[model samples]
Target: MPAKAGAVTMQQVAECAGVSMMTVSRVLNDDARVRESTRIKVMRAVAALGYRPNISARSLAGARSYLLGLLYANPSAAYISELLIGALKSCRAAGYHLVVESCDMEEAAIGEQMLALAKESRLDGLILPPPLCESAPLMAALEAARIPYVRIAPFTRLDAAPYVCIDDAAAARDITARLIALGHRRIGFIKGHPNQGASRLRLQGFQDAMQAAGLRSARRDICQGYFSYKSGLRCAEKLLNRADRPTAIFASNDDMAAAVYAVAHRHGLDIPQDLSVVGFDDTLIATTLWPPLTTVRQPIAAIAGAAVELLTTNRRAAAVLRQPAAPRRLLDYAIVERQSTAPPTTPD
Candidate 1:
């Protein structure tokens, strides 16, 4: 124990415990197949020796690669950027390296591309973000290859794999209700990309809130969007061009909400006074508008970090032990208020 800690090796631990290196490996992996007495002895020796295994050394001592992989094909740059920040921090802390790959969604078979990425990189595990997380082909490929992965926010198959996510529908409902509470009856909503599962939940949240308020969300008030700035611009134009425009708009994310701000300006509409706007994913874009936006915070970075930790630590094994279904970690969401939303003004 007085040793530098770094110099201790698995062999030293095994010898001190009077057991074979294989026994020590089984204990560390929590294989469950190892004898209780042997496992206890190996653990004590490991503690007494202060032996810390390097990534490569740890991999050699067990069946793990000690290398984690993350793949994403997200249209929202802000979300992906936050995801990387969190994932990288956790990987560094866990003494593991992250291999981030961007799969070509346009490829004929996304599953094949994922398979290539896994084999080419020798991934021990994977962390998948939106779009990629919901890819059936990718998930099937990983399962067939026996590579364990954790998803961020999957639309379906809640039991398919370990994951980290916020309650998208609940958060959306809260944000939408916030708009309604402000006495705005005609609130427009911009939907995100249909491909991303969270988008649907957010839209449902909006609809649920509107229905609860005894307000009918006219079809004209709901516009289609793709979670992109350009898409927001077009959708906003279509929704705001009419003389009977809504008094408020709730965008699925801050990026599109910012686009709504731009359209309001061109149309000579005054924020809060003439229009109220809200958004989701309390990313930085939420604050850049003239009157900062009120949005739902998704904790993108925290979700990413948790996903990495789950894969690198024993949590992944615990989840596997929960057989027939994967373990899921649900994080909290918050509604942030700013200058962008207020009670609608009365007409002269």
Candidate 2:
């Protein structure tokens, strides 16, 4: 009888590829010294056998878990869902598993717990999204633990730190300018929680755009929000209830934008007719609503994918790095204009 359909091993892979186990290992570990032809042959063998590396055995042999711990915070369902999809897809492609841990921003003990988690997992690297990335204690602990980590959105001024993110400030500024081009002089703004770096960057972008338009004093016109639909609704209510409402409202994210829609509905306002709204981070909620959001696309998948790529590839840092310190690559973002935004209308 033929060999069992499912039974496969590295030995078989080596034999099939006509390469030694050491060669196979080198290819799997992404050793650059290996010839491209040899790497392709080994990869073909790997595909043929449908062999999944024994992570545990590899970890024991290499003293590295080959696992990435992703620490994140955000209650937005759309944001979390998109982030997870991108992260898991990247991890799967790179032959690594992602361990996700949702953190509460208010918890003071989170830094200690995360450090303990990293130490115990023996993870090859870790991924942190803001505002945890901004936390001094968390940074100190990770530095002490000597675990390589990539910051998804850092609060500190970035100077070649390993990270993956869209240009939040630039995106926000672009969107705000778009609203101004649409003849919206009175634009209402809602900011995300101050703890998140993206939130701060986005707010700064709005301010920059307003200042460029000679609307610097418009800071008083913006309301603060926590990136939640409920927070969006409350702020939207406040803005609309005011004696002089903005012609257009800009929410830092899609969740808040949805809230603006709800509040507008409550006041019998016609979307794009009576009011126009724009949001950032073009997540699922952007389209699910009646008039899809005209917002800046965050490239969630690409960002998370890049983060995983950096983490997995860093596994070979010792061999790959010629210098003690290296710079990280950053990704770009785009503006996705949907139906929710339109030119301002004549006064009623």
Candidate 3:
């Protein structure tokens, strides 16, 4: 349906339904007292008349803004876009809107910013992801303000708080375990920026997998790189050009992993046969790369959807409600074994 210019009003739906404005309001609010027959009439009229309620007006009337504020610190364009799609879809479905704000990872006043957002008369709740969750001062400020929120990633100390995120370490472990099972003993790891909690968790997972396999991940086998294709290529060069090169490489995210492919190709190494590469975050780049990347899928949509729901859901302002039951949610992730991984070839 096309969105009409200017604001859509509820009074029109009331007039079209041949009912008092109160009746339309009651129906829209899902007031249980309204007769089912009346609701059906109002809904039918609503559909026919292209009725869209002005959320701003509703906020003024009910003292609820129905606005979800999304706070992000990640720099990856792909990650940001995916989260936006998920959050917006859920917000629209639930008759709410969103406000997005980006923050630099190193900012010291994240807590102050979050406090200001919560104090805003129009903001209902917040959806915090990554570094924000790990930020003690920021978390403390939000909790002090008693602003209802859902973290997109889990926190070690905030077990009681609602969150929607994937098992980052477990997913990374699974991906690494796959390479190990493929007989690639020497695996190189390309890390994302250290500021991201996902990067830390993923690196830990890789180490755990190697440890479980009775192997040690040496510092020489791992090179640091930010979550970028260029960084991946640079790190790959460092790892692959060595006299004793690892048989496989694992990147923290797909962008970096794709860079590894480019570097390997330039070095005259064939994917899977001479070297196998893997990555985390099975983004669109995973498929776009020459050989589809073997990576862990982060269920961006599901996590964003849950965050929006948690942020927009109503709760009493006075009551510290039992953290809204995490929307029976799980971050969907899978190891997409694509063209990027295989058994290592015997040294010629």
Candidate 4:
């Protein structure tokens, strides 16, 4: 009979599968040399027995710590939550543990914090999400310490390390062109945090769309934001308070777009009627709003999962080659059209 859950051992699993404990260990460690049939049989026995390996025991017996770390400094709760879910899922599948560390300190202090975390945790590898991914200090520190890492949506240093991202510029351009197709000649734009590289690419896309349509995007209509609800509130107020207010506004993120909804309601304006609002990063806030937000769907969870895969794959490759690898992955993005956009009431 199978052992009780949480009490199952590798020896029991091997006995159940008619395999040696060494074979079970190799399967659990994801050794590629294990035959397909044997791996499947071992996994079946593991599942049937509800076997949970003791990470500490496994580490003591092997060279690997079986620990991965995720370092982030982004302010979007939705983004971070999705990232965690994805990374955790991937880690579990790979028989690894995930340690999440938040770095909200200044740039000068970020490197030190990350290095300390690495040493303390004895992490096998790390995954970085923006704006930490774009931090030069953090990159230098990681390289100096020879810590394997993968980046999600890094703006600068594309060739510096492995990364996963969508074409931010193209996604921004497509969404902006969408507003134009709705006959919105005067559209407003809210830029994301200046610290991130994606912010610049997105802004460029918005500008490219407007210029292509032969529409003059006024300086006053383009406001700077930090990809936060508070920054969105400030930018929305600036644009909505103007006499020549834009008929539509596109924020760099959903949080800022949600802020626009609040400001529009305060000004006694109806969404998509008096003002049209759109955002990027089709996060939870996008659908929860009164009129669902029209935004660019950047697959946050998928990106995180891919980041973890890259790090694990790199670790395997380095074990044999004794050198790190840098690979880049570009995912796809989509423009989700909801009830939040409409043509301007009056022609430009």
Model 1 lDDT vs. the true structure? 0.84
Please, what's the RMSD in Å of model 4? 3.0
TM-scores for every predicted model: 0.85, 0.89, 0.82, 0.89
Count clashing residue pairs per candidate. 0, 0, 0, 0
In candidate 4, the residue pairs with backbone N, CA or C atoms under 3 Å apart (3 or more residues apart, or in different chains) clash, namely: none
Question: Can you tell me which runs of candidate 2 are displaced by over 4 Å?
Answer: 1-8, 15-18, 30-51, 158-160, 319-324
Can you write out model 3's per-residue Cα lDDT over 170-221, one digit (the tens) per residue?
9989999998888878999988877667788888999999999998899998
- Give lDDT: candidate 4, residue 317: 31
- Greater lDDT among 3 and 4 belongs to 4
Task: State residue 121's C-alpha deviation in candidate 1, in Å.
Answer: 0.8
What digit string (tens of lDDT, one per residue) describes model 1 on residues 13-44? 89999999887776766686788798779878
Off by over 4 Å in 3: 1-52, 118-121, 155-157, 314-328
Q: If both were scored by TM-score, which would come out higher, candidate 1 or candidate 2? A: 2
Clashes of 1: 0
For model 4 the local lDDT of residue 158 reads 57
TM-score of 2: 0.89
Question: What lDDT does candidate 1 reach at residue 340?
Answer: 89
C-alpha lDDT values of all predictions: 0.84, 0.81, 0.79, 0.88
